[model samples]
Target: MSASHVVYVLSCADDSLYTGYTTDLERRVAEHNAGEGAKYTRGRTPVAVVHSESHESRSAALSREYEIKQLSRARKLELVGGE
Candidate 1:
C-alpha cells in the first residue's frame, strides 16, 4: 500500500491556526516544533496537531489544506471540534 496524504490543522503557541498537507504527519509536526517547517509556522513553534484528515492522493490532501486555510477562524476551530 502507498503512504497516505494528510491535511492537518495545528494550534500554535500564539493562539493561531495553521493548515498544511504532508505524507508524513509525525515528521512534519516534529519539523514545525523544531523550527524547520513552514515559514508561517517557524516562529509559531510548539504547535499541536488539533485536527487531521487522511486522503488517498497528494492532490486531494493539498486541496483540502487550501480549503481549510480559507475557512474563518471560528469555522476552523469548529472543524477542530472547538479545540
Candidate 2:
C-alpha cells in the first residue's frame, strides 16, 4: 500500500473548485460524488477529479492543499485541464 496522503481537486457541480486530502482516494471520491463528503461539497456534487497528487505525509498534503487553494482559478485550470 502507498504510505502517502493524497491531495485531490474536485470540480463541483456549480463549476466551482474544491481541494482536500485523504488516504483513500477512491473512497473519498465516492463519498464526494454521493454528497456525503465535505461540507462545501455537500451542496455542490463533485463532477470529476481535476487533479490528484500523493505526498509522503499528511503535513505535506495539507501544505500542498493550501498552495493549490491559493492559486488563481486560471492557474488551477492550467494545473488541471479546464472543462
Candidate 3:
C-alpha cells in the first residue's frame, strides 16, 4: 500500500496563506514551522495547517494544489471553511 498524498494550506505568521502538496503532511508542516520550508514561508515562520485534502495520486494532489493557489484569498478562505 502507498501513503496518501495531500494538498495543504498553511496560515503564515503574517496571517497570509501558503499552499502546497506533500506525502507527509505532519513533517511538511513542521518544516514550515522550523523555517526550513518554502522561501515565501521561511521568513514568515510558525505556519500552521489550516486545511488539507488527501488525494489518490501525486498528480491529483498537485492539480488540487494548483487550483487552490489560483484562488482569491476570499475563495480560498471559503474552501478552507471560512475565515
Candidate 4:
C-alpha cells in the first residue's frame, strides 16, 4: 500500500461527503479530525473515512479525487455503498 497513494471519502459531522488525496491515510484522517486539514473540513469536524480508493501514483490519486468530487451526492453515496 505504501507503494501507492490514496483517494478517500470522508463522512463529515453534518453528513456531507468530502473527497481528497493523501499519501498517509491515517495521518490525513487525524489531521481532518484535529481541524488542521482542509478549510472545508475544519467546520465539518469529527470526520470519518467512509471509503478509500488506491492509485498507483500521486497524479492518479489526484485525478481520481477530482472525478469523485465531480460526482453527484447520490453517485458518491453509491460509490461508498450508501445506496
Candidate 5:
C-alpha cells in the first residue's frame, strides 16, 4: 500500500496560521475543525485547511512542514495568495 503523507497549513478562526504534517489530510483537518486537534487550535476552533502538499514519505512531508514553519509570515502570506 502507498504511504499517505501530507504537509498542511490551517487558517484558524483567529486568522492565525498553523502548520503540521499528517498521514491523513482529510481526517486531520476534520479533527482540527472539530476542536480536537492541536492545543494551539483548540482555543481557536473552526480551523480550515488552507494549503496542503502530498509527499512520498512521512519524513519528506515532515521536512516540508519544518521548511514551511520556518518561513516568515510575509513569505507564508505569499504562499497562501495573501488571502
Candidate 6:
C-alpha cells in the first residue's frame, strides 16, 4: 500500500494562491495555518485548501504542482471555482 500523492492549491489569508505537492493534504494544510509550511506560505498563513487533485505517484503530483504553479492567478482561481 502506498500513500496518496496530492497536488493542492491554497487560498491564503491575503487572498494569494499557492500551489504545492503533498502526500498528506490535511496535515500540510494544518502546517500552513500554523506558519510551518512552505516559506512562501509562512507569511500568508490561515490558508485553506481551495483545490486538490490526487495522483498515483509522487512524480505525477509534483509535475502537476509545477504545472499549476505556472498558471496565472486568475487561472488558478478558476481552478478553485473562482473563489
What lDDT, from 0 to 1, does candidate 1 have?
0.92
Which candidate, 5 or 6, has the higher TM-score?
Answer: 6
Local distance difference test scores for all models? 0.92, 0.89, 0.91, 0.93, 0.87, 0.89
What is the TM-score of each predicted model, taking all chains together?
0.93, 0.89, 0.93, 0.94, 0.91, 0.92
Q: lDDT tens string, model 2, 1-83?
A: 56679999999999998888999999998998898888899989756788999998889899999999999999998888884
Clashes of each: 0, 0, 0, 0, 0, 0
In terms of lDDT, the best-performing candidate is 4
lDDT of 6 by residue, 44-66 (tens): 88898889999998888888899
**What is residue 82's positional error in candidate 1, in angstroms?**
1.2
**What is the lDDT, from 0 to 100, of the residue 10 in candidate 2?**
91
Q: Which ten residues in a row have the lowest lDDT in candidate 5?
A: 74-83
Worst 10 residues of 3 by lDDT: 1-10
Ranking 2 against 4 by TM-score, winner: 4
* lDDT tens digits, residue span 1-83, model 3: 56499999998899899999999999998888888899999999888888999999999899999999999999999988876
TM-score of candidate 2 relative to the true fold: 0.89
Pairs clashing within candidate 1: none
Kindly list the per-residue Cα lDDT of model 4 for residues 1-83, writing each as its tens digit.
45469999999999999999888999999999998999999998899999999888888889999999999999999999997
lDDT, model 1, position 36: 96
Give the Å shift of residue 28 in candidate 6. 0.6
Give the winner by lDDT: 2 or 4: 4
Per-residue lDDT tens digits of candidate 1, residues 1-83? 66489999999999999998988999999999999999999998899999999998888888889899899999998999994
Candidate 1: worst-modelled 10 consecutive residues by lDDT:
1-10
Q: Return the clash pairs for model 4, or none.
A: none
* Tens-digit lDDT string for candidate 5 (1-83): 57589888888899999999898888998898787899899989788887888888888888999999999988888887774
- List the candidates ranked by lDDT, beginning with the highest: 4, 1, 3, 6, 2, 5
